[model samples]
Target: MELKPIKTRKIYEEIVEQIRELVVRGELKPGDKLPSERDLVERLKVSRASIREALSALEMMGLLEVRSGEGTFMRRLKPESVIAPLAWMLSIEKGTVQELLEVRKILEVQAAKLAAQRAQADDLRELEDALENMRQEIVNPELGGEKADLQFHYAITRATDNKILILIMDAISDMMQQMLKTSREKLYQGKYTPNILYSEHAQIYEAIKRKDPKQASEYILEHLSGVEEELNSHIE
Candidate 1:
Protein backbone atom coordinates (compact mmCIF):
# COMPACT_ATOMS: atom_id res chain seq x y z
CA MET A 1 0.00 0.00 0.00
CA GLU A 2 1.21 3.48 -0.88
CA LEU A 3 1.56 5.73 2.16
CA LYS A 4 0.65 8.95 0.44
CA PRO A 5 1.51 12.27 2.10
CA ILE A 6 -1.44 14.34 3.28
CA LYS A 7 -1.47 17.44 1.02
CA THR A 8 -5.11 18.58 1.30
CA ARG A 9 -6.39 21.30 3.64
CA LYS A 10 -9.13 18.88 4.65
CA ILE A 11 -6.66 16.48 6.13
CA TYR A 12 -9.16 14.72 8.36
CA GLU A 13 -11.49 14.01 5.46
CA GLU A 14 -8.57 12.70 3.43
CA ILE A 15 -7.69 10.35 6.26
CA VAL A 16 -11.30 9.22 6.50
CA GLU A 17 -11.41 8.58 2.74
CA GLN A 18 -8.24 6.52 2.75
CA ILE A 19 -9.37 4.32 5.60
CA ARG A 20 -12.81 4.03 4.00
CA GLU A 21 -11.12 2.97 0.74
CA LEU A 22 -9.16 0.33 2.60
CA VAL A 23 -12.33 -0.97 4.16
CA VAL A 24 -14.07 -1.09 0.78
CA ARG A 25 -11.18 -3.00 -0.74
CA GLY A 26 -11.35 -5.52 2.13
CA GLU A 27 -7.91 -4.54 3.40
CA LEU A 28 -9.73 -3.72 6.62
CA LYS A 29 -12.22 -6.55 7.14
CA PRO A 30 -14.96 -6.58 9.66
CA GLY A 31 -13.71 -7.15 13.24
CA ASP A 32 -10.20 -6.23 12.13
CA LYS A 33 -8.54 -3.76 14.47
CA LEU A 34 -6.87 -0.72 13.04
CA PRO A 35 -3.35 0.48 13.79
CA SER A 36 -3.09 2.68 16.84
CA GLU A 37 -3.53 6.44 16.59
CA ARG A 38 0.24 6.96 16.77
CA ASP A 39 0.82 4.40 14.05
CA LEU A 40 -1.89 5.92 11.85
CA VAL A 41 -0.41 9.39 12.34
CA GLU A 42 3.01 8.19 11.26
CA ARG A 43 1.73 6.15 8.30
CA LEU A 44 -0.60 8.84 6.98
CA LYS A 45 1.88 11.64 7.73
CA VAL A 46 -1.01 13.55 9.31
CA SER A 47 -1.55 15.03 12.74
CA ARG A 48 -2.96 12.81 15.49
CA ALA A 49 -5.94 15.16 15.67
CA SER A 50 -6.77 14.40 12.03
CA ILE A 51 -6.64 10.66 12.65
CA ARG A 52 -8.89 11.05 15.67
CA GLU A 53 -11.40 13.06 13.68
CA ALA A 54 -11.47 10.48 10.89
CA LEU A 55 -11.97 7.66 13.34
CA SER A 56 -14.76 9.57 15.02
CA ALA A 57 -16.45 10.12 11.67
CA LEU A 58 -16.18 6.45 10.80
CA GLU A 59 -17.72 5.52 14.14
CA MET A 60 -20.66 7.81 13.50
CA MET A 61 -21.15 6.17 10.12
CA GLY A 62 -21.43 2.79 11.86
CA LEU A 63 -18.39 1.53 9.99
CA LEU A 64 -16.00 1.35 12.93
CA GLU A 65 -16.27 0.93 16.67
CA VAL A 66 -13.72 2.35 19.12
CA ARG A 67 -13.09 0.62 22.39
CA SER A 68 -11.66 2.77 25.20
CA GLY A 69 -8.35 0.91 25.40
CA GLU A 70 -8.73 -1.86 22.81
CA GLY A 71 -8.40 0.33 19.71
CA THR A 72 -10.81 0.73 16.76
CA PHE A 73 -12.25 -2.19 14.81
CA MET A 74 -14.25 -2.40 11.60
CA ARG A 75 -17.89 -3.31 12.23
CA ARG A 76 -19.78 -5.83 10.15
CA LEU A 77 -21.84 -3.42 8.09
CA LYS A 78 -25.61 -3.69 8.04
CA PRO A 79 -28.00 -2.28 5.49
CA GLU A 80 -29.95 -0.67 8.33
CA SER A 81 -26.95 1.49 9.25
CA VAL A 82 -26.74 2.79 5.70
CA ILE A 83 -30.41 3.83 5.76
CA ALA A 84 -30.47 5.05 9.36
CA PRO A 85 -29.24 8.56 8.63
CA LEU A 86 -31.89 9.13 5.98
CA ALA A 87 -34.53 7.61 8.24
CA TRP A 88 -33.56 9.98 11.08
CA MET A 89 -33.53 13.03 8.83
CA LEU A 90 -36.97 12.14 7.51
CA SER A 91 -38.25 11.73 11.06
CA ILE A 92 -37.68 15.48 11.69
CA GLU A 93 -39.30 16.80 8.52
CA LYS A 94 -42.82 18.13 8.15
CA GLY A 95 -45.41 15.41 7.41
CA THR A 96 -42.86 12.79 8.36
CA VAL A 97 -44.75 11.65 11.41
CA GLN A 98 -47.56 10.33 9.27
CA GLU A 99 -44.98 8.69 7.03
CA LEU A 100 -43.51 6.96 10.03
CA LEU A 101 -46.96 5.85 11.06
CA GLU A 102 -47.54 4.47 7.61
CA VAL A 103 -44.27 2.58 7.61
CA ARG A 104 -45.05 1.18 11.02
CA LYS A 105 -48.45 0.12 9.84
CA ILE A 106 -47.08 -1.66 6.79
CA LEU A 107 -44.30 -3.51 8.55
CA GLU A 108 -46.42 -4.46 11.56
CA VAL A 109 -49.52 -5.43 9.67
CA GLN A 110 -47.47 -7.97 7.77
CA ALA A 111 -45.63 -9.01 10.90
CA ALA A 112 -48.95 -9.71 12.59
CA LYS A 113 -50.05 -11.83 9.69
CA LEU A 114 -46.81 -13.77 9.68
CA ALA A 115 -46.89 -14.27 13.41
CA ALA A 116 -50.42 -15.58 13.22
CA GLN A 117 -49.32 -18.18 10.72
CA ARG A 118 -45.99 -19.10 12.29
CA ALA A 119 -45.92 -18.26 16.00
CA GLN A 120 -44.76 -21.19 18.14
CA ALA A 121 -45.86 -21.86 21.69
CA ASP A 122 -42.93 -19.89 23.11
CA ASP A 123 -43.67 -16.98 20.84
CA LEU A 124 -47.28 -16.91 22.02
CA ARG A 125 -46.07 -17.00 25.60
CA GLU A 126 -43.82 -14.01 24.95
CA LEU A 127 -46.77 -12.04 23.64
CA GLU A 128 -48.79 -13.00 26.68
CA ASP A 129 -46.02 -11.90 29.01
CA ALA A 130 -45.68 -8.57 27.26
CA LEU A 131 -49.41 -7.95 27.41
CA GLU A 132 -49.56 -8.84 31.09
CA ASN A 133 -46.70 -6.49 31.78
CA MET A 134 -48.60 -3.70 30.08
CA ARG A 135 -51.71 -4.47 32.08
CA GLN A 136 -49.78 -4.34 35.33
CA GLU A 137 -48.16 -1.08 34.33
CA ILE A 138 -51.52 0.58 33.67
CA VAL A 139 -51.02 3.08 36.45
CA ASN A 140 -47.27 3.44 36.04
CA PRO A 141 -45.95 6.95 35.54
CA GLU A 142 -42.43 6.00 34.49
CA LEU A 143 -43.35 4.76 31.00
CA GLY A 144 -43.38 1.11 32.03
CA GLY A 145 -46.51 0.53 30.00
CA GLU A 146 -44.78 2.04 27.00
CA LYS A 147 -41.83 -0.26 27.39
CA ALA A 148 -44.17 -3.24 27.45
CA ASP A 149 -45.95 -1.87 24.42
CA LEU A 150 -42.66 -1.84 22.52
CA GLN A 151 -41.92 -5.36 23.68
CA PHE A 152 -45.31 -6.62 22.56
CA HIS A 153 -44.59 -5.48 19.03
CA TYR A 154 -41.05 -6.78 19.19
CA ALA A 155 -42.31 -10.21 20.18
CA ILE A 156 -44.56 -10.16 17.16
CA THR A 157 -41.58 -9.28 14.96
CA ARG A 158 -39.59 -12.11 16.49
CA ALA A 159 -42.35 -14.50 15.59
CA THR A 160 -42.06 -13.61 11.95
CA ASP A 161 -38.82 -15.66 11.77
CA ASN A 162 -37.43 -13.48 9.01
CA LYS A 163 -33.94 -12.20 9.61
CA ILE A 164 -34.21 -9.27 7.20
CA LEU A 165 -37.53 -8.24 8.67
CA ILE A 166 -36.09 -8.46 12.17
CA LEU A 167 -33.13 -6.28 11.19
CA ILE A 168 -35.36 -3.63 9.65
CA MET A 169 -37.63 -3.62 12.66
CA ASP A 170 -34.65 -3.36 15.00
CA ALA A 171 -33.29 -0.47 12.94
CA ILE A 172 -36.33 1.71 13.52
CA SER A 173 -36.97 0.45 17.04
CA ASP A 174 -35.33 3.39 18.86
CA MET A 175 -37.48 6.01 17.14
CA MET A 176 -40.56 3.84 17.57
CA GLN A 177 -39.83 3.51 21.28
CA GLN A 178 -39.90 7.27 21.65
CA MET A 179 -43.11 7.49 19.67
CA LEU A 180 -44.70 4.78 21.81
CA LYS A 181 -43.79 6.72 24.95
CA THR A 182 -45.49 9.82 23.58
CA SER A 183 -48.52 7.72 22.68
CA ARG A 184 -48.78 6.12 26.11
CA GLU A 185 -48.46 9.52 27.76
CA LYS A 186 -51.29 10.82 25.61
CA LEU A 187 -53.42 7.83 26.56
CA TYR A 188 -52.64 8.49 30.20
CA GLN A 189 -53.81 12.05 29.76
CA GLY A 190 -57.25 10.69 28.74
CA LYS A 191 -56.99 11.46 25.04
CA TYR A 192 -58.28 7.90 24.69
CA THR A 193 -59.35 5.35 27.25
CA PRO A 194 -56.64 2.96 28.38
CA ASN A 195 -59.10 0.07 28.24
CA ILE A 196 -59.46 0.51 24.49
CA LEU A 197 -55.74 0.07 24.03
CA TYR A 198 -55.68 -2.97 26.31
CA SER A 199 -58.65 -4.60 24.62
CA GLU A 200 -57.18 -4.04 21.17
CA HIS A 201 -53.89 -5.55 22.16
CA ALA A 202 -55.70 -8.52 23.63
CA GLN A 203 -57.57 -8.94 20.38
CA ILE A 204 -54.27 -8.97 18.50
CA TYR A 205 -52.89 -11.60 20.86
CA GLU A 206 -55.99 -13.74 20.51
CA ALA A 207 -55.94 -13.57 16.72
CA ILE A 208 -52.35 -14.77 16.63
CA LYS A 209 -53.05 -17.49 19.19
CA ARG A 210 -55.89 -18.82 17.08
CA LYS A 211 -53.72 -18.74 13.93
CA ASP A 212 -56.07 -16.34 12.20
CA PRO A 213 -53.77 -14.35 9.93
CA LYS A 214 -56.57 -12.22 8.53
CA GLN A 215 -57.89 -11.24 11.95
CA ALA A 216 -54.40 -10.59 13.21
CA SER A 217 -53.63 -8.32 10.32
CA GLU A 218 -56.92 -6.50 10.66
CA TYR A 219 -56.59 -6.00 14.40
CA ILE A 220 -53.08 -4.61 14.12
CA LEU A 221 -54.01 -2.30 11.24
CA GLU A 222 -57.00 -1.04 13.15
CA HIS A 223 -54.85 -0.46 16.19
CA LEU A 224 -52.30 1.49 14.15
CA SER A 225 -55.05 3.45 12.43
CA GLY A 226 -56.54 4.50 15.75
CA VAL A 227 -53.12 5.52 17.04
CA GLU A 228 -52.41 7.53 13.92
CA GLU A 229 -55.73 9.34 14.22
CA GLU A 230 -55.20 10.13 17.88
CA LEU A 231 -51.62 11.24 17.33
CA ASN A 232 -52.55 13.50 14.44
CA SER A 233 -55.46 15.03 16.31
CA HIS A 234 -53.29 15.80 19.31
CA ILE A 235 -50.17 16.97 17.47
CA GLU A 236 -51.41 20.42 16.24
Candidate 2:
Protein backbone atom coordinates (compact mmCIF):
# COMPACT_ATOMS: atom_id res chain seq x y z
CA MET A 1 0.00 0.00 0.00
CA GLU A 2 1.25 3.47 -0.89
CA LEU A 3 1.80 5.66 2.24
CA LYS A 4 -0.45 8.73 2.41
CA PRO A 5 1.59 11.85 2.88
CA ILE A 6 0.79 13.75 6.08
CA LYS A 7 1.86 17.36 6.43
CA THR A 8 3.40 18.05 9.86
CA ARG A 9 1.45 21.20 10.81
CA LYS A 10 -1.91 19.78 9.77
CA ILE A 11 -1.19 16.28 11.04
CA TYR A 12 -1.06 17.53 14.63
CA GLU A 13 -4.34 19.38 14.23
CA GLU A 14 -5.98 16.47 12.41
CA ILE A 15 -5.00 14.14 15.24
CA VAL A 16 -6.21 16.62 17.85
CA GLU A 17 -9.58 17.11 16.15
CA GLN A 18 -10.02 13.35 15.79
CA ILE A 19 -9.58 12.85 19.52
CA ARG A 20 -11.85 15.76 20.30
CA GLU A 21 -14.52 14.29 18.02
CA LEU A 22 -14.22 10.99 19.87
CA VAL A 23 -14.91 12.73 23.18
CA VAL A 24 -17.64 14.89 21.68
CA ARG A 25 -19.32 11.85 20.21
CA GLY A 26 -19.08 10.16 23.63
CA GLU A 27 -16.73 7.43 22.42
CA LEU A 28 -14.33 8.70 25.09
CA LYS A 29 -16.03 10.22 28.07
CA PRO A 30 -14.24 12.22 30.70
CA GLY A 31 -12.00 10.01 32.83
CA ASP A 32 -11.83 7.38 30.10
CA LYS A 33 -8.26 6.35 29.46
CA LEU A 34 -6.72 7.08 26.10
CA PRO A 35 -4.66 4.31 24.52
CA SER A 36 -0.93 4.28 25.12
CA GLU A 37 1.34 6.44 22.99
CA ARG A 38 2.58 3.35 21.23
CA ASP A 39 -0.98 2.27 20.54
CA LEU A 40 -1.87 5.71 19.20
CA VAL A 41 1.31 5.76 17.15
CA GLU A 42 0.20 2.56 15.50
CA ARG A 43 -3.53 3.28 15.13
CA LEU A 44 -3.25 6.88 13.95
CA LYS A 45 -1.12 5.85 10.91
CA VAL A 46 0.98 8.94 11.72
CA SER A 47 4.35 9.61 13.29
CA ARG A 48 5.02 9.50 17.05
CA ALA A 49 5.91 13.20 16.92
CA SER A 50 2.48 14.13 15.60
CA ILE A 51 0.82 12.02 18.30
CA ARG A 52 2.94 13.57 21.05
CA GLU A 53 2.40 17.12 19.89
CA ALA A 54 -1.36 16.65 19.63
CA LEU A 55 -1.58 15.15 23.09
CA SER A 56 0.56 17.93 24.53
CA ALA A 57 -1.77 20.56 23.09
CA LEU A 58 -4.82 18.72 24.34
CA GLU A 59 -3.26 18.63 27.80
CA MET A 60 -2.63 22.35 27.68
CA MET A 61 -6.25 22.99 26.63
CA GLY A 62 -7.42 20.95 29.65
CA LEU A 63 -9.07 18.52 27.31
CA LEU A 64 -6.81 15.71 28.54
CA GLU A 65 -4.44 14.91 31.37
CA VAL A 66 -1.33 12.76 31.10
CA ARG A 67 -0.20 10.71 34.04
CA SER A 68 3.43 9.54 34.02
CA GLY A 69 2.72 6.43 36.04
CA GLU A 70 -0.51 5.74 34.18
CA GLY A 71 -1.69 7.14 30.83
CA THR A 72 -3.69 9.96 29.25
CA PHE A 73 -7.37 10.41 30.16
CA MET A 74 -10.19 12.44 28.66
CA ARG A 75 -11.15 15.66 30.49
CA ARG A 76 -14.34 17.64 30.82
CA LEU A 77 -14.97 20.81 28.88
CA LYS A 78 -15.18 23.74 31.26
CA PRO A 79 -15.11 27.30 30.01
CA GLU A 80 -15.22 28.64 33.57
CA SER A 81 -12.04 26.83 34.49
CA VAL A 82 -10.17 27.98 31.38
CA ILE A 83 -10.99 31.68 31.55
CA ALA A 84 -8.80 32.85 34.44
CA PRO A 85 -5.45 31.73 33.14
CA LEU A 86 -6.46 32.63 29.62
CA ALA A 87 -7.29 36.12 30.79
CA TRP A 88 -4.11 36.53 32.81
CA MET A 89 -1.83 35.35 30.03
CA LEU A 90 -3.68 37.48 27.48
CA SER A 91 -3.71 40.57 29.69
CA ILE A 92 0.08 40.80 29.96
CA GLU A 93 0.86 40.00 26.34
CA LYS A 94 1.94 42.94 24.17
CA GLY A 95 0.10 43.93 20.96
CA THR A 96 -2.92 41.80 21.94
CA VAL A 97 -4.82 44.68 23.51
CA GLN A 98 -5.17 46.84 20.43
CA GLU A 99 -5.49 43.85 18.15
CA LEU A 100 -8.22 42.47 20.37
CA LEU A 101 -9.92 45.84 20.43
CA GLU A 102 -9.85 46.12 16.68
CA VAL A 103 -11.40 42.66 16.43
CA ARG A 104 -14.06 43.63 18.95
CA LYS A 105 -14.90 46.84 17.14
CA ILE A 106 -15.52 44.93 13.95
CA LEU A 107 -17.67 42.33 15.67
CA GLU A 108 -19.49 44.80 17.88
CA VAL A 109 -20.34 47.13 15.05
CA GLN A 110 -21.76 44.22 13.11
CA ALA A 111 -23.34 42.88 16.28
CA ALA A 112 -24.99 46.22 16.82
CA LYS A 113 -26.35 46.08 13.31
CA LEU A 114 -27.70 42.61 14.01
CA ALA A 115 -29.11 43.71 17.32
CA ALA A 116 -31.00 46.48 15.58
CA GLN A 117 -32.72 43.81 13.53
CA ARG A 118 -33.43 41.48 16.46
CA ALA A 119 -33.68 43.52 19.62
CA GLN A 120 -36.74 42.97 21.80
CA ALA A 121 -38.26 45.11 24.51
CA ASP A 122 -36.24 43.47 27.21
CA ASP A 123 -33.11 43.90 25.19
CA LEU A 124 -33.78 47.59 24.89
CA ARG A 125 -34.32 47.77 28.64
CA GLU A 126 -31.06 45.95 29.24
CA LEU A 127 -29.20 48.48 27.13
CA GLU A 128 -30.96 51.27 28.99
CA ASP A 129 -29.82 49.81 32.27
CA ALA A 130 -26.25 49.72 31.02
CA LEU A 131 -26.48 53.33 29.94
CA GLU A 132 -27.79 54.23 33.39
CA ASN A 133 -24.75 52.65 34.96
CA MET A 134 -22.51 54.78 32.79
CA ARG A 135 -24.33 57.84 34.01
CA GLN A 136 -23.91 56.87 37.64
CA GLU A 137 -20.23 56.11 37.16
CA ILE A 138 -19.31 59.41 35.55
CA VAL A 139 -18.39 60.92 38.92
CA ASN A 140 -17.03 57.58 39.99
CA PRO A 141 -14.09 58.01 42.36
CA GLU A 142 -12.25 55.45 40.29
CA LEU A 143 -10.08 57.17 37.75
CA GLY A 144 -10.94 54.82 34.89
CA GLY A 145 -14.08 53.37 33.44
CA GLU A 146 -14.41 49.85 34.79
CA LYS A 147 -17.63 47.91 35.28
CA ALA A 148 -19.61 50.63 33.57
CA ASP A 149 -17.86 50.27 30.23
CA LEU A 150 -17.96 46.46 30.28
CA GLN A 151 -21.61 46.37 31.22
CA PHE A 152 -22.48 48.59 28.27
CA HIS A 153 -20.70 46.47 25.66
CA TYR A 154 -21.72 43.20 27.27
CA ALA A 155 -25.36 44.22 27.06
CA ILE A 156 -25.01 44.87 23.35
CA THR A 157 -23.22 41.53 22.81
CA ARG A 158 -26.02 39.75 24.64
CA ALA A 159 -28.62 41.54 22.58
CA THR A 160 -27.03 40.16 19.42
CA ASP A 161 -27.93 36.64 20.63
CA ASN A 162 -24.67 35.41 19.16
CA LYS A 163 -22.63 32.95 21.20
CA ILE A 164 -19.46 33.65 19.24
CA LEU A 165 -19.62 37.36 19.96
CA ILE A 166 -20.27 36.83 23.64
CA LEU A 167 -17.48 34.32 24.04
CA ILE A 168 -14.95 36.50 22.25
CA MET A 169 -15.96 39.48 24.38
CA ASP A 170 -15.66 37.48 27.60
CA ALA A 171 -12.27 36.05 26.65
CA ILE A 172 -10.84 39.52 26.02
CA SER A 173 -12.47 41.32 28.96
CA ASP A 174 -9.26 41.43 30.95
CA MET A 175 -7.26 42.95 28.15
CA MET A 176 -10.07 45.35 27.32
CA GLN A 177 -10.05 46.56 30.90
CA GLN A 178 -6.32 47.17 30.74
CA MET A 179 -6.66 48.98 27.45
CA LEU A 180 -9.47 51.02 28.93
CA LYS A 181 -7.14 51.91 31.75
CA THR A 182 -4.41 53.03 29.38
CA SER A 183 -6.76 55.05 27.18
CA ARG A 184 -8.53 56.55 30.15
CA GLU A 185 -5.30 57.63 31.78
CA LYS A 186 -4.27 59.52 28.68
CA LEU A 187 -7.61 61.19 27.81
CA TYR A 188 -10.09 60.66 30.65
CA GLN A 189 -9.24 63.81 32.55
CA GLY A 190 -8.79 66.34 29.80
CA LYS A 191 -9.98 67.42 26.32
CA TYR A 192 -13.20 65.44 26.73
CA THR A 193 -16.02 65.10 29.20
CA PRO A 194 -17.68 61.97 30.59
CA ASN A 195 -21.01 63.34 29.41
CA ILE A 196 -19.68 63.25 25.87
CA LEU A 197 -18.97 59.51 26.01
CA TYR A 198 -22.27 58.85 27.70
CA SER A 199 -24.06 60.60 24.87
CA GLU A 200 -22.20 58.57 22.29
CA HIS A 201 -23.19 55.33 23.99
CA ALA A 202 -26.79 56.51 24.20
CA GLN A 203 -26.79 57.13 20.47
CA ILE A 204 -25.52 53.64 19.74
CA TYR A 205 -28.03 52.08 22.09
CA GLU A 206 -30.88 54.01 20.52
CA ALA A 207 -29.84 53.02 17.03
CA ILE A 208 -29.76 49.37 18.00
CA LYS A 209 -33.15 49.64 19.62
CA ARG A 210 -34.58 51.13 16.44
CA LYS A 211 -33.03 48.38 14.28
CA ASP A 212 -30.81 50.86 12.48
CA PRO A 213 -27.52 49.06 11.83
CA LYS A 214 -25.97 51.92 9.92
CA GLN A 215 -26.41 54.50 12.64
CA ALA A 216 -25.48 52.02 15.36
CA SER A 217 -22.21 51.34 13.59
CA GLU A 218 -21.67 55.01 12.98
CA TYR A 219 -22.10 55.88 16.66
CA ILE A 220 -19.63 53.23 17.83
CA LEU A 221 -17.17 54.13 15.10
CA GLU A 222 -17.35 57.79 15.97
CA HIS A 223 -16.83 56.99 19.65
CA LEU A 224 -13.94 54.62 18.98
CA SER A 225 -12.41 56.91 16.37
CA GLY A 226 -12.07 59.75 18.82
CA VAL A 227 -10.25 57.53 21.27
CA GLU A 228 -8.16 56.00 18.51
CA GLU A 229 -7.01 59.36 17.20
CA GLU A 230 -6.12 60.44 20.71
CA LEU A 231 -4.21 57.21 21.37
CA ASN A 232 -2.36 57.62 18.09
CA SER A 233 -1.31 61.16 18.88
CA HIS A 234 0.27 59.98 22.15
CA ILE A 235 1.66 56.62 21.01
CA GLU A 236 5.25 56.06 22.18
Identify the leading candidate in terms of TM-score: 2
**Model 1: how far residue 135 lies from native, Å:** 1.2
Candidate 2, 195-220: lDDT as tens digits: 77788889999899778989998888
Pairs in steric clash, model 2: 116-211
lDDT of all the models against the reference? 0.82, 0.74
TM-score of 1: 0.68
- Candidate 1 lDDT score at position 95: 47
Candidate 2 C-alpha RMSD relative to the actual structure = 5.5
- Give candidate 2's TM-score: 0.70
Candidate 1 has an lDDT of: 0.82
Question: Which parts of model 1 have CA positions greater than 4 angstroms off?
Answer: 1-54, 60-62, 65-96, 139-144, 188-191
Candidate 2 residue-wise lDDT at 23 = 59
